[model samples]
Target chain A: MAPTILILALGCAYNEELPEKDILGTVIVPAAAATRLQADGTTATDPRFIGPIFLGAYSGIDTVSFGYPHPSMGPIVTADTPGDAFPYGGTTVGRYDFACYESLACKVVTGRFSDYNDMLEYFGTVLGSPIQDDNGADVANGSTFQQACYDYFYATSDQEMAFLGDLDFALNADGDFEAAFVMPHTVFVEGMTIWGWMDAPEIVPANPTESGGFSSCDVSTGREFDQYDENFREGRVYFDALNTPSQYIYAGDWVASGAEEAVVNSPDDKPVVRLDFGFGVGEAE
Target chain B: MRTHGNLALGALLALSGLASGCTNVRDGFRPVLTDAPFVYDIGELRVIGAEELAGVDPSTVPDAVHYGQLGAGENAGLYGGATFQFRATGSSVCVVVDPEAMFWNKEISTQSNTVQYKFEDIFEDDGDLDLSAGLAAYYTGSPGSEIGDFSAVYDDPAGVEHELAFNECIQTGYFGDPAHAGRATVEYCDIDTSLHSGVMYTAVLETFALPIDDSILNFGALAFDGRCADLPWYDSNGALLAGASECVIPNEVEYADANGIPEEKAWFPELERAYCSGVGKVNTFCKDNPGAGCQSEEEL
Candidate 1:
């Protein structure tokens, strides 16, 4: 009887060692950007405004362009439209008409195409002609048409692939603004890419001449791609399967390194990834 | 037989241990309250004007328009702003009113309005003068043609006069038109002698408006007890004046202590009113007294 009881106790203690299937990490922002005054007179340190930071894991799926309706459909495919126009058929496109469809497609296509001139040439060919936008202008196959399609798309595909999460920075015991996130273990599998942004004001000046104090990227005047690139230039850092030497990957240099080297293990064994804005050094204790 | 029994006992013990461990893991996931990054101690004053459908065409106004607390959600109230006049004696702190102090909502075009004020913003010294005690007079009036002379005067024990300005008024372009003009005044005060170490003082909020007799006439006042003190005026015989009941002062200390919760706290007066009206969350005050007016929560 004594031996049976001892065995039961040992089994319970050993079961506690089983690993949790989640990828744990911390996001660090420069003190200057976190403390900068927002338009509402409150800084990112305030919880109300701290939720702009987004993190998403991609399965390397081509969900943006190839997954939706064919480009020949002119950026808008409604439920009533013929199913043959879309590659995957009508049920997948939902009830999206021309007006609502253009905004989403433009944002996704803009994120996928990095170069401004290259996007102009590519969209100019694929987007059909005589597609009148909301302002009653012929936007097909023109630079003005391509500029209209620009906005923030977090992942490579629209399905959110493997995981999508948002981090909210709050004043910790040490009074520093910090956010933490946990991704699924499947995100570490091969052919998966992780990307995110702090959704904060531009840390570095966009114009070469202007200096001092951060400024928000103006999207209304057809500067969506510039704003997207500015967000990446502010800071980029990620943890892959390979445990590569963690460092900042600025705008033009960022590439989605597939998680071929990721090691599936407990959160305790993984190192924390820091996303730092150029203003100051951020550390995770 | 003995060997077989020992092997069976070991297996059973291991299974029991593993089951217990799984329970412990699930228990760890239970949520517990954490410290909030910021805390706000808020006090809300809801002023609902009575139905005023005299001069204007009643057919043009919607049923919901007459109610002071408009909109859908819990934060909805009279959509205008008020000027809180704070007068203190026994202290030389100059009370400066920020021009942008009024919280106005132009959506509702009625005389009803709700004013939400934070205790820390008014009393706490953020490199400014710290206010102890006196009188907090809140003056709110309906839409008038031009800005009126809305002012208050406070006399301390030493006979030195301190004039506090309450010059905030809602102005409309149609002042000359009798159909759109009306007179509705909601005045209340809060006096807490125990909270601050200062001399007792009396203050008055006088509002002057254009004479437009045909507009809707409605006057409604609601004051929370313990937090509200009546503005008392006595004759030589030391008798309370006739209109003393019309004014109620807010006790700043008790107001803060009632609504200030260190971990995750927010108080909505609309929710309290709904609770008092036997519709929403069960309030203790409303529960104890069946028909108690949904005064703002004295202790949240």
Candidate 2:
């Protein structure tokens, strides 16, 4: 006779091998911008108001609203705001030490645009599907407009169109300025947009189209987009582990084409996405 | 059988706990090491003669060393003038001499100096280890003692070529130690050259010394130049000796051929080993057993 017995062990183990949640990168600004320029040029020696750059990343099918005239979609991270909220219980802000930048502190404002809907409502645009207004008439979405926009722009179905966390800039060991963004690995698909706003105003501007001539997220009557060249810089890149090298891109190139689609489609881990800014000190032409 | 199984499980759990608790988890992780060395490019080498020393208060010129009672303007000499590069590693300092440069004098052809340059022993620890304690110990020990010697040939204003030997060179500069922030001046005494003329010609030259700023520590190029080996070797009794025959490590081609390692991979370590053996004091094992692998005796 043979004794028959079965044993089963059921216990939860801590997942030490969790996928990295942040895309890390370095940001190198001009020496002049790093030194004296304040957020508003009030205290700057150069009076350029180009100090304390604001950086953000958007997960949409299109790159249209990533820059200025869309201040309602506030910056998710800035030097002042730490522990700001983001998706999946993550902080909207990343790590930054003022000392690394040769400054005792930095002054910048965090935008209110934390997710996709806030961006769409502010821009009054949609992505794949058209939503009916109170009159049952179809509203203008990204697809119908035939304008340059990404598919993930206004879709709420999946995690595709989500605001990636904001990042704070700091100087690395190599003496280069850098910033890192923490977002779900799912947001790194093709058509991701990374944007930076140098010398961003402390107050986000009002959107004229909204009821009361102002959007809910508007903080004040903002400066005109044409007034400052620091208004917009956008790039389309799929940042994953394999493509995770510090990228040197110019801030003046408003529509910079980054990594190729084929490379972006390939499977890889989500590592730090290094972004170096080539914007030197001067007025925008 | 059940009791035995429980006992085994308990022992396993205990062992696991002990292993996890006792071992340093941080040691298991690899630390980020910087490759660039702390480069102190001499912006200007201000050489003041003994006569200039007369007008200035001795207290004001803390680095002023009296070499010889040489005449004023005639005594000031420049060897490897401005842009002279001083590359500091954790353990040794290499005064790079560009032979093609005008001040170095092409006629001398880069003669080797017999003085070995080293930081206080505390810097030799692993790059990942904190060096604050070592820096504290060094600054506290003898802040003004001569760390090494320097030698070069310079023609005086009279066009007479004379070998400039700084036997008592005191390194003074703000190493930017957290405790000490002001300048720690470095004064090199031309003792050897002064002895010949019976005139102590101390040319007090100012240098932007080591650990340029406070935030950086143990930062510099890992590879020691072959010219660094030109520092004179010393016997066990501190007697000045001639150049060691083993000082010449095999070139990349020779090293590759003998060990079957590719020259590309073998070159850097071989070059460093050659420097260590040439200097004698940095790595004694490399000096004693040149044929062995690049591991220092301390490492073995």
Which candidate wins on lDDT? 1
A1-285 in candidate 2: lDDT tens per residue? Answer: 122222222124445445333444333333333333222323332211223332343332122433321111222211222211111112223221111000111221232233334333432321111233324354444333212123213433323322222324555666544444443343343333333333321211232222111011122222222223323112211222011111212233112122222112222433332223333323321
Q: Please report, in order, the local distance difference test score of every candidate based on alpha carbons.
A: 0.26, 0.26
**Model 1 TM-score (2 dp):** 0.18
Model 2 misses residue A161 by how many Å? 33
Cα lDDT for residue B60, candidate 1: 36
Per-model TM-score of chain A alone?
A: 0.28, 0.29
Query: Taking the candidates in order, what DockQ does each have?
Result: 0.00, 0.01
Say which candidate scores most in DockQ. Answer: 2
Residue B181's lDDT within candidate 1 is 18
Candidate 1 interface RMS: 33.4
**Largest TM-score belongs to which candidate?**
2
